[model samples]
Target chain A: MSEKGIHIEEHRDDEASKLGMWLFIFTELLLFGGLFLVYSIYRWQYPVNFHEASLELSVTIGVINTIVLLFSSMTIAMALTAIQKNNKKLALRLIAVTLLMALIFLINKYFEWGHKFEHGLYPGSDLMALLERGHLLYFSLYFFMTGLHALHIIVGMILLIIAYFKVKKDSVNSDRFVFLENGALYWHLVDLIWIFLFPLMYLIT
Target chain B: MDHNKTHITEYKVLAKILLLLIFCTFLTISITSFNLAAFTVTIALLIAGVKGFLVLSYFMHLKYESLLLRILVGSIFLLFIIIVLITFIDYSFR
Candidate 1:
């Protein structure tokens, strides 16, 4: 037999990578799940306080943010489609659109939190300290869950920017785009958390 | 083995899903004006659940994923519900 050269095959498993992304998603879900559990128990205990506290949140802004996040989710999903179709420019543009929407969401959030601060509604304020137990729990969970959610948004934006650069460098291309795909999944998870949070915190009145 | 071509969701489909989600959002807000009493939160949550499902199946493309992944994701949600239910039961009887 003729001597054969050693063939070094580069390891690749997109499915495994995606599965890993989902497992991480499971953890994320559970983490938020714990918070949601806390929210339910407290809300049940202090239904009236939760109701009045939720009324303090502007439905107009919550509605706007919901639309913004849903729109961003669509754009990111469309970006995946664009990449698959070899339309790199369209994909990047869609990603840019998604990022813009994320910025808009944060801006709205900033104004919303600013409104709260103006009223001494923030945690650790003397006003908060004087609030009754149920009302206090409501604001604390509000700051905690929404703050955690905003932190996730920042992280997702960073991930998308990195994925954007990877795609720009052609390190993640049409044929191999799982990295970008996973980032989009994480973005969707952010949207998912807000979907629950919006009604629980804003519309439950 | 030849790798099958990945499914590419149509841009139009994604746009439609967004519209549907927006409609659902409006629907929730509209329902708020009504005095459904305790049913208000329940209805809002149901709509949110629907929105979550749409985002999961379409935006995240979980619908097209393999059965194993689907079952796994489904079970995780089930477990979350179970945990919440158990906690509620404990607190309710206490």
Candidate 2:
């Protein structure tokens, strides 16, 4: 049953890829772990200050970004599904859409941050004067955490763009949907990170 | 093994579920803006958790995967979250 053996090996490779991604995701969590520790210490020491600072953030922006990320997640899924079904054209289109949406997300974040910076609300700037003591700490954490998360989104977009072109050139076929699958997994991780950040940054009472 | 039929059905269902999640997100935002701070955050996170579950189970194909693999991944994710919370709590408490 040499053929059966080969089949098993193929399956194992897929599992290995998934396992590798999972490990990377775990590392990502730890990366954010350090930030979470910093936030809690600051927040604990000055709860009232942080609460007041939190109000400066625009919930509308956070909500819109959440929607953008969620929509990107959907597009990535559709891309993978397209590849699985051997619809290369569809896959390419979906990946392109995802990349575009990611670009829009970055644009939105830039404007939001720019507004704050213009108002002298930047870190180590006049943030203390523009908002309450608690709020400054909260905004600082928001900027740092969300800035890091935004970087991840940028990286994910680059990966997806590369995958899109590869799929466009028929470089990745239905028999080899691993690229799209992994790309989607990365996007989902980005989405997961935002899901947590949204509440921590914008929803604390 | 009608691959075409199965693929179509899966894609359709996934799309519908994602749309519903998007709607839920909008609803959460709308409800929270009314000054219900405690309920808003909790409900928003609860909805987000639900949405994440759907992505993992349906879109990511975790449901069709092996139980061992599922447990392995789930435990790792949960462990990471625990580590984060614990460190945060330690700092906050200190």
Candidate 3:
């Protein structure tokens, strides 16, 4: 079918693509897992400071964000189901809802971080430097872990956006939905990391 | 497209799973208010692990994946645990 009368094949192996996505997710898990290891060790060394620092965090906001993410995860999962059922309209609507949830979550995080900045609680700030080593480490890990997770949220949002467009264009449907599936997988991974982060950062005893 | 191989998870089941996750989250938060000391982290993590499993199996559809894929995923977690344990041993002695 080419200009030279030679046939060319389009590589569209869905299973292989999904496998690659899962492998990428494995690396992400390990990346965050290492940070978690560091957090556990430091918490062991300075339990009291970590506890006190954790108390300073707004549990109400943390809980709200957790609920938002859980709901968003459900919406994305539902979006996949919609597409599987060949309901493009419902799928697009669900994806839109998921995107809105992501925005709400980031907005809440912005305000939460803004409040901390107002109190001069950021890493390398004078207030943080004045604190003991344990408190310093606590805030440092807090920012690093949550910050990384937020970055993932942004990336996942982009993926969902692409999936949204693909679904609209008919490139991804019930028969060809690997793109959407992978995007949902990425979103779920984001939610999963937050599941652990909520406990470690917000529920410190 | 292997239509026969694809699994279409029901919406009701997904909703139920989400409800369970939310319940577990609340349970974790409430339990932390009590003074369980060292056991608090363990309990919180255990609940989180359950929630993670639910998301993986239901939301991510890992439950319907091939055995090779499942093993690949499982081995990653296993290796991570082994690494964590080895590190704990070193830290404990020091």
In order of the candidates, what TM-score does chain B achieve? 0.93, 0.75, 0.94
With candidate 3 superimposed using the best TM-score fit, by how many Å does residue A92's alpha carbon deviate from the native? 0.1
Better of 1 and 2 by DockQ: 1
**Regions more than 4 Å wrong, model 1:** A1-7, B1-4
Return the TM-scores of chain A for each candidate in numbered order. 0.96, 0.87, 0.95
Error of 1 at A182 (Å): 0.1
Off by over 4 Å in 2: A1-12, A126-133, B1-9, B30-42, B84-94
Superposition TM-score, candidate 2 onto the true structure: 0.83
Backbone clashes in candidate 3 total: 0
Badly placed stretches (over 4 Å) of model 3 are A1-10, B1-4
Q: Evaluate every candidate with DockQ and list the scores.
A: 0.81, 0.39, 0.85
Scored by CA lDDT, what does every candidate get?
0.92, 0.76, 0.94
lDDT of 3 by residue, A1-205 (tens): 8899998766688899999999999999999999999999899999999999999899999999999999999999999999999999999999999999999999999999999999988978999889999999999999999999999999999999999999999999988898999999999999999999999999998
Model 2, span A71-184: residue lDDT tens: 888888888888888888888888888898899899999999999889887778855556665676677788889999999998898889888878887877786666767878
Candidate 1 CAPRI classification by DockQ: high
Candidate with maximal lDDT: 3
Query: What lDDT does candidate 3 reach at residue A95?
Result: 99
Worst 10 residues of 1 chain B by lDDT: B1-10
